[model samples]
Target: MSTHETSAREEVDAIIAGAGGWRAEALATIRAVIISADPEIVEEIKWRKPSKPEGVATWTCRGNVCMADVLKKAVRLTFPRGARLDDPTGLFNARLDGSTVRAIDVFEGAQVDEGALRRLVLEAVAENRAG
Candidate 1:
């Protein structure tokens, strides 16, 4: 590998090593979203995985449970206010046809639209903070 490629690989390895789990990338993504949206968001571990307080749905931004799901090749990011995003890219749940409710999911082998995810996270943080 070229020096640059080697350096990048080393950096990723270091990050993964320090990240502390098999779900490190997902954890990092979620944490980046939360921190960008609200630095004050309280993070705690529940059921041995990271959980955050989403407000209103069963796993609302203010609710006690913010869901985290990981699969053999990908991770899921489910938000409590998933139904409220100003924009939708068919990236959410199949069952949610309502205007203001659903789940944001990141699946394997498909590129997640980061902009959409950011908007969802931004809105979720706002919803939770408003509570």
Candidate 2:
């Protein structure tokens, strides 16, 4: 991995570590899936602020693949170009009305379809590359 990507991954790790309870667990699980889906995928932290220093976790390849945001009630994983991808499994449960972005909201105790999630990550990567 490149130096920037390495730094970004480390930042993301810190973000995950800083989270508590279900948020941290969900973020870690999603991070694993994103990384496992593509060896070359880059992880980054974005949208930092004073109140939320950790910001959001962004996974990318040729372009933005997805970003995982830890919310109060759920962990939302959003794809910037989700409208163009085929989500037959219906993993994307939120942001469906948007023109481009789509998201999957994982609440506490929710069981993520690992295989399907991985496939979605792969598909998102392909879409990014094509664009």
Per-residue lDDT tens digits for candidate 2, residues 7-119, read 88888888788777888988898889889999878888888899877778898799889998878899999999988889898899999999999999999999888899999
Q: What is the TM-score of each candidate against the true structure?
A: 0.53, 0.92
RMSD to the true structure for each prediction, in A, is 10.4, 1.4
Tens digit of lDDT per residue, candidate 1, span 1-131?
A: 55754553354344434545545665456545554554444443334323422211122245532455454444555564656555555667532766545655555445556676666666676766676
RMSD of 1: 10.4
Model 2: how large is the Cα RMSD against the reference? 1.4
What does the lDDT come to for candidate 2? 0.88
- lDDT against the true structure, per candidate, is 0.50, 0.88
Candidate 1 overall lDDT versus native: 0.50
- Give the lowest summed-lDDT range of ten residues in model 1: 52-61
In terms of TM-score, the best-performing candidate is: 2
